[model samples]
Target chain A: MLTVNNLHASVDGKAILRGINLKVNPGEIHAIMGPNGSGKSTLANVLAGRDNYEVTSGEVVFQDQNLLEMEPEIRAREGVFLAFQYPVEIPGVSNLYLLKAAINSVKKHRGEEELDAMTFLKLIKEKAALVEMKQEFLYRSVNEGFSGGEKKRNEILQMALLEPHLSILDETDSGLDIDALKIVAHGVNTLRNESRSMLVVTHYQRLLDYIVPDYVHVLAHGKIIRSGDKSLALELEAKGYGWIEDHASAA
Target chain B: MAGLKIMQVQPDTMLASGTQFYLDQFEQISDKLPGQNVDWLQSSRNNNLARFGKNGFPTQKDEDWRYTPLKPVTGKAFNLKSAPTSGVEHEDTRSQSALRPIPGLNCHRLVFVDGFPEMSMSDIAGLDGKVSVRSLSEVLAEDPETIRDLLDSVVGESSHGFAALNGALHQDGLVVMLEEGAILSMPLEVVYASNQELTLVQPRNLICLGKGAKAQIIERTVSLSDSSCLHNSVTEVILNEGSELDYYLIQDQSRSSYQVCGVWARQKESSRFSCHTVTFGGGLVRNDLRSEMTGPGAHCDMLGVYSLSAKQHVDNHTTMIHGAAHCTSNELYKGVLDQRSRSVFHGRIKVEKDAQKTDARQSNNTLLLSRDAEIDTKPQLEIYADDVKCSHGATIGQLDETSMFYLRSRGIDPDVARSMLTYAFVNDVLGQIKIEPLRDYLEKALGEQLIREKKLFGQTK
Candidate 1:
């Protein structure tokens, strides 16, 4: 579903992602774990085509199309979603309004009929319920004065509505408490399907407990040095990243 | 033309050519002006005309007029002429289109063509007997003493040259007077349409509400002529004790038109006054809003929103005076400038020494959509009372980058994203409008403006 070969990226003339390569097939869930400053979020942003992150030399192909050449909105319309670590607080644009516009844009790009107001409302309600979001939150400004849990849930609600082909969850559990973690994890687990692919980026292994992944890769110094099954996350949780750093240096 | 009187121009006063031209026009029309036979009215006009001749148009040197330049208005020559005795017999489609009534707004409608009240087009019947609505000319001809003190009472000895010009040369306007305890269930809609080339239209409106009375007034100024014209209007309001008034002014003129408007209101004890000013058009425009709280427990709110594009320029100056104890005032003005358009907002709040327990808050915010677009915002607060609570703030910025990106990242087109954020920036003030139909109309108009501006600039970022 996605391919990243020798992805070399930088920000402000400083190298962040150096010689990184990864591949994910259909229906596969890959968890990228790394310590602080290991370029986990940077990789997610690069895939989403954030303007600040400059791709020095690399190639990113999504569904056999070059993703790096597309604009951010084009990438989004092409079924690429990035759940930001910090959801922006937009004071005037209502959550429901943004969701509707987003869905229609993607649908229009796919040559599908736009959803009517009634149908859009029904779909948004169902998605909000999946993330345990109240109906009132959808009418309010997007993430303005929202609690940490509500913002994370809003992101998931958007994800469920968009139903993107490649969903990159970047530190989705950073500010969420245990209960919120369960809710978000449950929403993701419910959305799992045979044709969907997800790249879960996290510094802690607690999020994986709820939404287990098919593969776990340890990213160190801008490169994935280790790949294993679910057991690898458990090992990293038990033994700190120090052991992995030492092992990578020895190897 | 048979009754024309040529008065001598004063040579002692040094005036700019623009000022001399207006002074000469006023001399020619003074004899035919309404209430010319009344001693007090004539004397007030003479005094204000003298003041205007001395100062000419306000220069940038004046403290209150620092951010606005008057060259565009002064450099052009506008003839001062009286309105035709009767309404236009032929229906001019341009002026007719400008006078189209707002849908779903049921109210007392009054239309003015080139500063003259159009009785044929007005609908003020079925009004409560206690409430009197008539044209200023009619009142002046019948009994000028009735409105002698109310006219120019709120704006006494005004410093603004435009206000003085309006005081001296105002041809015709609307006068609404309500008796004690009388309430107006429907809003009063006043539409002023300017449709003559190089003509000067000055309208003076007086609204007096007695004790315990309540009323809502909406004033709209529109331009129907393709040629450039000058529209100078002044509205004075007097609210008695416990009376409440809501006044809205919407200025949407032609791109080549020049407009200057001033609204001065005085509130008695326990009275409430609110004014909303929305400006969308005009080549050069200036709006001065002043409210004085004269009695205790009185409250005043001033809210304004302006959207300027192209080379259009707009200046909004507001003053809130807390003269009595226990009075509160709030002011909020926002603007969106795109392309080379410019906007200025100056808000001042004053709490007198005897006015204790006064609460006043003022804020001005502007959003610049292009590098060439500029805004000058200033919020001033003068609290003479030690126990008063007063705050003022101003902010000028571009479209927030993060907000723009967030919207675009969700598949919204960049143009749509920019427009959405721009609308959001001014939506707060728009939401405060209580009239649903008016607010809806403004929203649609402003939405179209945003889209049109986007197309004109084509991706400013």
Candidate 2:
């Protein structure tokens, strides 16, 4: 469903991603494990077309279309989702209002009829239940004064509502408690389908325990040094990234 | 006559041509002004006319008037005639449409055409005994002594050119007087519609609320003609002990119109006063709002919101005075400017030496949508008392980049995102309005304005 070939990106003349590459087919989950400053989040942001993350020389294809050439909103309308590590706090735009506008925008781009108020309410209620979010939260400002766990859950709620084809989870488990981590993992597990793909970027192995991935790639020094199955994550957790770094350097 | 003689003696080159024109026109209309036989009223007019002539409209050299220039107002020799011009006769259909009542608001409405109260268009049937609502000209003709003590008391010995001009040239306005313990259930809606081009309309409103009285007023100024006009208005309010008043001024005029408005209020012990000024359409607009808290336990709130586009310019100046102990005041003003429009906000808070335990807070925030749009904000606080809490802050910026990206990343179009954030910036002040219908109307109007501004300046960004 997605392919990245020799993706070299920089920010403000500072190289962050250097000659990186990855591929994911339909219905497959890829877990990207890395140490600090390994360009994991940078890769996710670059894939999402965030400004300031300039793609120096690279090619990203999503469903046979060039993804890097599109605007951020166009990428989003084309079914590319990035769950931010830090959700923005918007004081006046309500969560429900944003959800409606987002859904309608994507639907309009896809030549589908917009959902009425009743249908939208019902659909949003079901999605909110899937993420275990309260009804009152949808009426409040987006992520303003929200707790860490609530913000993460709100992101997942949006993901469930948008139903994007390729979802890039950027450090989604950093600030969440164990209980919230379980709920987020459960929501992701429930949304897993034959046509959906996900790139789970995480630092610890705890999140991988709940939402197991089919492949685990170790990203060190802006490149994926090792590729293996779920067992690589367990090994990295047992023996920290130091062992992998030494082995890759010696190789 | 003495003031006219003094003005005539001054060299023609020494006085601005606009001020010279008004001075010449005042001589022809002074004898026909209302309250001609009343000594105090006539003396007050003469003194203010002299003051206006001496100042000749404030220049940018003045500290308070640094950001605002009166060239547009002073360049034209606007008509000073008290009577409505022939174009706006009683049967004029456009005047009626301009004076239409606010939808969903049930109240006693008084309409004014060219500064004169239109009795045929007003509806104040059930407000006779409970509340005294009369035309200022009628009151001045019948009994000038009734409002002598209240008129011009709030703006005492001021040197503001517009205020002085309004004091001297005001022909007709509204006078609302409430007795002790009286509660006005319905809001008083006053609509001032300008239908004459190149005409100067000065309206003076006097509101006196006795002890424990409560009232709400909605003052709206609109323009019916596309031609350039000038509207100079002054409203003075006196709130007795334990009284409460809510005043909302909505200025939506023609694109070629110039407006200068001032609202001065005085609050007694345990009284509460709140003023909401919402400005939308005008070529050059200036609003001066001042309130003095003279008694203990009194509270005041000054809230405002303005939206401007094109070459529109709006300036809002507010002053809060804490003259007694245990008083509190809060001020918040916000503006949205797009497409080379400009705005200014100057907030001044003063805590007198004897006014201990005073709590005052002020904030001004603005959003500029285009590259050329500009805003100048200044917060001045003079606290003489050591045992008081006063805080002031101001911010001028564009729509937040992170917030924009957040909205756009969720699939909202960039234009829609910009409009949403712009509306949200002003929603803080709109949410404080207690009247539902008025708030709803403003929200709808502001929404339409945002759409219009987007279409006009969407490509500039």
Candidate 3:
């Protein structure tokens, strides 16, 4: 579903992701675990076409199209979704209004008919329920004065509504309590399907216990040094990131 | 006058030429003016003409008009008009124009054409007998004493040049007086339309609300002519103790016209006054809003929204004075400038020494859609009382790039996203309007303006 060849990205003349390569097939869930400053979030942002992250020398292909050549909005219309670690707070723009505009925009790109207000409202109610979001939050301004957990849930609600082909979850488990982690995992698990692919990036193994991944990769110094199954996450959690750092240095 | 060599001529001589021109026009139409036979009004006009001749028109040198130049309007000659004896017989083209009647607002409509009040086009039959609504000409011809008293006291001329000119030339307007404890169920609409070239008209309106009375008045100025015209309007409001009044000043003049308006209000003890000023179209427009809280517990709220594009110029000046103790005032004014348009905002709040426990807040914000578009805003607070709370701020900026990106990332077109954010920038100020239909109309008008401006500039995709 997605391929990254020698991904080399930087910000402000400082290299962050150096010589990274990864591949994900259809229906596969890949987890990338790393310590702080390991370029986990940078990789997610670079894939989403954030302009600030300059791709020095690399190419990303998704759905038979060069994702790097497309604009952020075009990438979104082509079914690439990034659940931001910190959702933007946009005042005076209601959550429902943003969702409707986004849905209609995608529909227009796909040559599909736009949904009317009544039809859109029904869809929003159902999707909002999947993430356990209250109806009042949908009417409020998008993430303005919202709690951390509520913002995370709202992101999942958007993911469910968009139904993207490839979803990148960047630190969605961070700043979330146990209950919030469970809710977020439940929403992700419900959306799992045979044709969908997800790249889950996290610093902890707790999220893997809920939405168990097919493959686990340990990223160190901007390179994937270890690959294993779900048991690898538990072994690393019991030990520590220092053990991986020592092994990666020896290799 | 031009025979006098341009550079060799003294500045005072040059200024006198402009003022003398209006004084000569007044002399030709003095007999046709309202309250001509009244001794006090005649004297008032004479005194105001003399004052205007001395002050002439304000220049960029004046601190209040430093950011707004007057050469565009004052450099040209105008043909002053007197009251039209009979109502205009032209087809009512308002149905096709942008000035549509606000739906669901039961209003008493008054129409004026070329500066003359048209009784045939007005609808005063719905007004209760208790509320007195009369054309300024009728009142001046029959009961001149009432207006004479107001002009001598509350609605007197100010030192502003255009206001003095209006005082010398104003012949027809609306006179609405309410008795004590009276409440108007319907709003009063005053519509002014100009249909002449190089013509100048000054319309004066007087509103007097007795104690405990409540009323709402909307004044809209528009032009149907394709040629250049000028509208110098003045509105005077007097709110007695416990009275409430909501006044709306809407200016949508033709692009070839120049408009200047002045609103002066006085509030008694415990009275409340609110004014909403909306400016949409004009070649060069200026509005002056001045209010004084003379009684304890008086409250005033002033809000404004303006959108300008192309070569349009709009200036807004507001002043609130707390003369008594326990008074409060709030003000918010926002504008969007596109193309080569320019806007100026000056808001001042003064709390006197005797006015304790006064709370005043003022904010002015501007969004520039083009690099060439300019905004000069100043919010001033002068508090002399120790127990007063006064705060003022002004911000001038472009659209937020982060917010723009957020909207674009949702697969929305960049142009549509830009227009939506522009509308949202000024939506809060419009949300304060209590009249639902008026608010809806303004929102639609502003939204269309954003779209039109985006198309004109061919914004980035």
Q: What docking class should model 2 receive?
A: medium
lDDT of 3 by residue, B396-447 (tens): 8888777776777667677778877887788888888887887887888887
Q: What is the TM-score of chain B in candidate 3?
A: 0.93
Pairs that collide, model 2:
none
TM agreement with the true structure for every prediction? 0.94, 0.93, 0.92
lDDT of 1 by residue, A1-251 (tens): 99999999999989999988899998899999999999999999999888789999989999999999998899999998999999999998888889999999999999999999999999999999999999999999999999999999999999999999899999999999999999999999888999999999999999999989999999988889899999999999999899999999999
Candidate 1 scores a C-alpha RMSD against the true structure in Å of 5.1
Name the regions of candidate 1 deviating beyond 4 angstroms: B1-16, B36-39, B85-97, B119-121, B456-461
What's every prediction's RMSD, in angstroms? 5.1, 5.4, 4.7
Q: What is the C-alpha lDDT of each candidate?
A: 0.89, 0.89, 0.85
User: How high is the lDDT of residue B421 in model 1?
Assistant: 88
- Pairs with backbone N, CA or C atoms under 3 Å apart (clashes), candidate 1: none
TM-score of predicted model 2? 0.93
| Model 2 lDDT tens row, B1-461 | 75553212223323357777888888989887788888999888988899988987887898999998888787777776656565455455655555677789888889888787777778888864757888898999998899988898898877498889888888789999999988888999998888776778898999999999999999999987766789999999999999999999999998889999999999999999999999998899999999999999999999999999999999999999999999999999999888889999999999999999999999999887778998999989899999999998888888888888888888888888887888889988999988889999898889888876677756622
Ranked candidates, highest TM-score first? 1, 2, 3
Task: Tell me how each candidate scores on DockQ against the true complex.
Answer: 0.68, 0.67, 0.54
The TM-scores that each candidate's chain B achieves against the reference are 0.93, 0.93, 0.93
